[model samples]
Target chain A: MLRTQQLEYTYPGNKTITFPDIQCEKGSQWLLLGQSGTGKTTLLHLLGGIRKPQKGKVYVADQELNTLSSTALDQFRGKNIGIVFQQSYFVQALTVGENLQLAQTLAGHSADSDRIKDLLSRLNIGNKIHDRTNRLSQGEQQRVAIARALVNSPGLILADEPTSALDDENCKEVIDLLETQAKEEGATLVIVTHDSRLKAFFDHKIILQ
Target chain B: MNPLTLSWKNQKDRPLQMLLTLLLFGLGVGLIALLISLNTQLDEKFKNNLAGIDLVIGAKGSPLQMILSSMYHIDAPTGNISINEVKPFLNPKHPLIKLAVPLSLGDSYKTFRIIGTTHEYVDSIFRGTVASGKRWEDLYEVTIGANVANKTNLKIGDQFHSSHGFTDDGINTHDHGDGFKVVGILNKTNTVLDQLILTNTQSVWAVHDHEAEEKQAPAEAVAADDHDHDQDHASEAAGQEDHAGHDHSGHDHADHEGHDHDTHDHADHQAAGPVMKPLIEYPDKDITTLLILYRNRTSYQTLSMPRNINENTDLQAASPAIEMNRLFSMMGVGTDALRNLALIIVIVSGLSIFISLFSSLKDRKYELALMRVMGASRSYLFFLIILEGLLFAILGYLLGLLLSHGGMALLSGYLEEAYQYEFSGWRFFKEELWLLGGSLGIGFVAALIPAFQAYRTDISETLTTY
Candidate 1:
């Protein structure tokens, strides 16, 4: 349901960083590996409508987010695109339950209590849901962010080096969760990472130097 | 529970800022309530002075001043008039003129204005029914209004001295006498009478050691003149009733003017009072003001006050209603300005709320983006910022209103007693409600800008670099 053709975006405020084209489609697990300053994040931002591509278009469900009003784009992004930051940032004052509730609220839906309980239980965070997000470890917080992203069942999932803070075992657990959860939700998962360890989780890979 | 609960949770995220906003709202609203309560109290105390009396007769000057001095214990008398003006109207024949109670005011008891008149004035004008004791037994004996008795703590048979001028700080000695017996104490009227000492006109003249008839009697002539004119007009209006044999009317008219004046000339007029023999009937001077109660509403210009004052008659007239309206308009501008300033402050507060919510969003953009990627909508993000603003504004408004009410309650009395004003605590007018709505509106107003920012955040960019 989501695809981008010849999506070109340029990094601002630099004479040397050039625009690049990217193409992607839904229902596929894709890996975008780029060296430092290769515009991987820029491309992702453009795809998410955080920054518009200087040229080309991104179509989600056959509709262009670029063509929609700024307000509509936010709603569209909130409901259909979930991004996981390398360093997870949750609202500090809120408990885990509240953090997820915020995500659901931002997506313009009430928190589904039953679905939330099941998701937390599945993610092994059922007990942590009522605890303050700040009290959780980096790995735990990352899981919370992931749960928040998946709460609305968006069609596209974006993860940016999400496993950087976790050890080898927790990293595997997180990666597996993303892959399996995306498959279950019928979502296209795109992970941006420089780590070779995560390469095996996806079927297709694009490496940038 | 609603989205705004987050701001409440995050209050310490900007602790000083939150406290400052609360303080600003509280202080601003408190000042407003303070000024309002003070004004109300002053108005109340002033109102007490004008309470109960139907009319005021005086030499025409400022109606406000006359009311202030005669009805209230503030300001000085414009001058006095010969009572001949309202005397003719005091005719028992005139169905309308109930009692032409003449009031002569020149001296003051302490800071309270001393009213010199007959027992009729003591009964009707002062409305004192011997709360503690008997009526004035002799010249120089007096009945004190409620506030006066309270301030001095004088009871029946007590004697108190008077002061010369209307201000307590004045150096002049009491001209009326060394001491006047407290023959009567009046209940509190909460009006000008509260600050007065009432005595018979003969006593007033006695203090000056003047023959009573020469100075006091002619003051009634002023009311008589107006009384007679009104009677002539009434007679003309009733001319059609001539066939009904107006002999009763004619007899009443003659007796009305004839008996009172002629009776005083007689030795044993029991209604005259204890010192009636020495009251030394001058029989002409009337009260300081004629409280002209007309059937139709009359304008100040039409009150014949200017004509009375113009002949250098030492008399001026004033309309209480006109002066009061003027006072209200004059005060309204100041109040409106203050309220507007309050509104502007609220708006500024709202803008600060917007800045706080919007700028804070920059740091939280990544989390927001993640949520968006996870099936959250742009509207959801927008609501987060707006709700934050809503949270801040409403909290401020509630606290401000509470502070306002508390301040009013504390200042109500000081405003009334000290400033000659009136104030009611816990009493809110419609204007205060408007203030609340306007204050709360600031949140929404500030929200519009930040909502724009949220709608524009890039979910992809907000996520951290790999």
Candidate 2:
């Protein structure tokens, strides 16, 4: 579960972005929508504990993120939060499976190959597990990124414009994979994107202005 | 995966850079390792072979040459000292002298020198035992040293004609209807004796001057004569044994002084060539050198005797210890320069690694940030860069070590074949450990700035901006 209240952040140039209160229950799919310059990425970072808000009560898995030390926040984030970016950027030198395993390792969890294989099989990229991430097709790489996010069974999954680079068919397939995978892993999914096509996929929406 | 696997994958992502780093670092490490091994071994060999005799009295020439030629048997003899000229020190009645072993050098069986001396030289000075058969019982009966027998494949009873010069490939030959007979062989002694053919002084003279007709005494009679002569000298030498005993113990104490002063014991292996044949009295006889053992290492006679011989006699007295040090210092300058140059190469290689890592950081920032978002701490990212650096250094060191040994083995082969000199490539040096640590230190230092940069990478800025 993830929730944020009256989060306010200021950039170095004195620009401020005020966010609305947010809530996402377990296993629910939600979208954070905004036009360009609305600070959707800033809000995503704030919720993920990667950035500290100027003033806010940010909670993830029933714990106040800002109250934890940097090291503890890193540990807490690793164990409970998974993030997918706009573009698939796996460590290019590693295999698809290795990239997923890296997520588990960095999260301070033992590698679970069966979980990884099962996740990949659900995404139809299980056969490409040993293939280098850089050698995979764009669609397959996106699928691997999704697998990496869900490998640790995190409570919160934040996807920042994950399907923005894909064509219509690939965008639909990737979005479906992310939603279905997050549902299967029982994680609350929050996607921040400018893509209007994603509006129909999720019922819960928070539009940032 | 683990950090190591990640480091390896990172290296693989940039193969050219990785190879360049390895070669640069490897060459630097290889050259230094090779130098240390060579310097250690050469220094040991030079030090290990400089003991026993106090003076090397040979014909007037370079004292280093005299020592090298007669004592080490590595250079051409410095002309020849006549028996009459060297007779004062050789006399059993001489008060300051304890033992004088005469060496006659001119001929060779292959590369080994054919040395003619008295039986006392072999039995007393060298303390040698015949591995097979008996000591020479007749003229031209030669006792082969262990190395000579092994290299030339000569056996007892195998007769071999001597060449005219010291070289094995010399064109001039000695065929006087008499070839030297290998009547016996000496065991390996790890001294100059291992590379010589031993016979009586008369055998060398007879080989050079075939026209001299010599009256031959019965074998038993000559043996009896040498036995009488050795006994007379033994009794006379016994009266001076107290000083000699002190000299022996004093030399042992001097060993702990330093490696430069450690005296290698050279037990003289004498030939005696069937002392049955009477030797023509010394007057015009030209022997290569005379090795003298003093009654005491520090006796007033030992110090004054060399100066006395050099000033009063035609023969020059050379001290092995002094000449060898001069040789080492002279050789040291060139090798030290080479060693310093290798050190510079290692440093330059470290810089190259630094530049490569620094340049790669720009391209790797996005991936690093992704790792951070995946929950890797800043410290983990910092260590990843450092690990990559250490991996480069370790791989380079391993390759460099192999290159150095391979190069040394090649050089050792050439030296063995050309100069009969042994340079072992198998010896491990303590400096190698230092070299390893040095390489790792360089790697760590070179990666410092890049690793710090990785630690400071703002994950949110990198991820959002990209």
Interface RMSD of each: 3.5, 1.1
Q: Considering summed lDDT, which 10 consecutive residues are worst modelled in model 1 chain A?
A: A14-23
Candidate 1: residue B151 Cα off by (Å): 12
Model 2 lDDT, residue A48, Cα = 92
Off by over 4 Å in 2: B118-130, B134-137, B211-273, B276-280
Q: Which candidate's lDDT is highest?
A: 2
RMSD of each: 12.2, 11.1
Measured with C-alpha atoms, the lDDT of residue A126 in candidate 1 is 93
- Please, what is the TM-score per model? 0.65, 0.87
* Top DockQ hit: 2
| Candidate 1 structure lDDT | 0.64
- lDDT (tens digit, per residue) of candidate 1 on A1-209: 65676666655664333434445667788888877678777766766677777667887767887898866776787788887777877777678888777777766777677777777887888999789887998878888878877888888888877887899999999998888888888888888888788888777888876
